[model samples]
Target chain A: DVKVTQSSRYLVKRTGEKVFLECVQDMDHENMFWYRQDPGLGLRLIYFSYDVKMKEKGDIPEGYSVSREKKERFSLILESASTNQTSMYLCASILGGRNTGELFFGEGSRLTVL
Target chain B: AQSVTQLDSHVSVSEGTPVLLRCNYSSSYSPSLFWYVQHPNKGLQLLLKYTSAATLVKGINGFEAEFKKSETSFHLTKPSAHMSDAAEYFCVVRFSGNTPLVFGKGTRLSVIA
Candidate 1:
């Protein structure tokens, strides 16, 4: 079975602090993504990486950045955390091909900014 | 761009009754559709998917969905509702390969005994 692991299951940070959420996948999938889930708003894509060191901004990329230094690891970075940034963060990976790829997701990291 | 719309925000059903969650989608091209279930404080799990190969797709936990291209809808259904099946259900769509998956707001399922 494919497994995607997130470094932290829960986190708390003060306003204006820097925060990092890490995700790693054992399947060596080429596509990785970061999404923030909120009630009524659904899951909004923050960033995604298609290859090592290659990244693209998603629909809601403001105040967030991502790093993909290796094929197995993807990191979400909040330059300066704010209270509005408190939400559930999800990471997903998919095999980069035309075989109807389904996203394998991590357990998710819930971040709280106070 | 591809998008999904979940018609109901909350659905309540009695245990052992049939379950239905409505979804509609819009896409420029033929889209790949999916149904996902998320338990409280947990990640989303794939329930089923439609890739044009089959219109009626069966999924885990006795759930199924039928894709209707003419109506632009893919609705999830279950033979019998169980308490464990209560969760937030999301409808998702992808335009093509290599693009991000678009999700609906989600429908919260509540099963009553």
Candidate 2:
């Protein structure tokens, strides 16, 4: 069984505060992704990393950045959290080099910005 | 260029009844379509995938979806609805090899007793 663990299940942050959501996958998957999920919007990709130090912007990348300094961990960082950024964040990974492979997801981290 | 659409925002069915969740995608020569279910407070799980194989694809928990090239549709179906089947269903499309999957606004399924 592949396990994708999220550092925080829930977090509360004030506007202008820096926020970080950490994700770690045990499968040594080559690709990791960060997605923001909201009602009716499904899941919009924020950023994806194919390898360490390599990142690509997704559909909704504004106000968000990601770090993948190591293969087992991926982190999503919000430089300055805002009310609009309050949503459930999901982290996922795939084994192969191709990004279109079936994703293994983590139990999402729900954020509340005040 | 590539996108998927879930027809219903919400669907309700009584236990033991039939279930149908409609999904369609934009035109693409040969696309990979997938159905994913997200249970409450849980991460999304892959229900089934259609990678230009057999038209009818069977998935876990008695779920199945059929791929129709003429209509460009990949709708999910189940013979009997279970209480545990209540969840949000997402239809995803991948235009080709490395392109990211495009997701539709999910359809929330509600099961009644």
Residue A92, model 2, lDDT? 87
What lDDT tens digits, residue by residue, belong to model 2 across residues A13-111? Answer: 999999999999998887888989999899999998877888899999999999999999999999999999999999988754333557788999999
TM-score of model number 1:
0.96
Estimate the overall C-alpha local distance difference test score of candidate 1.
Answer: 0.92
DockQ of each: 0.72, 0.57
Clashes of each: 0, 0
TM-score of chain A of each: 0.97, 0.95
Where model 1 places Cα greater than 4 Å from the true spot, the runs are none
The stretch of ten residues in a row with the least summed lDDT in candidate 2 chain B is B93-102
Question: What DockQ was computed for model 2?
Answer: 0.57
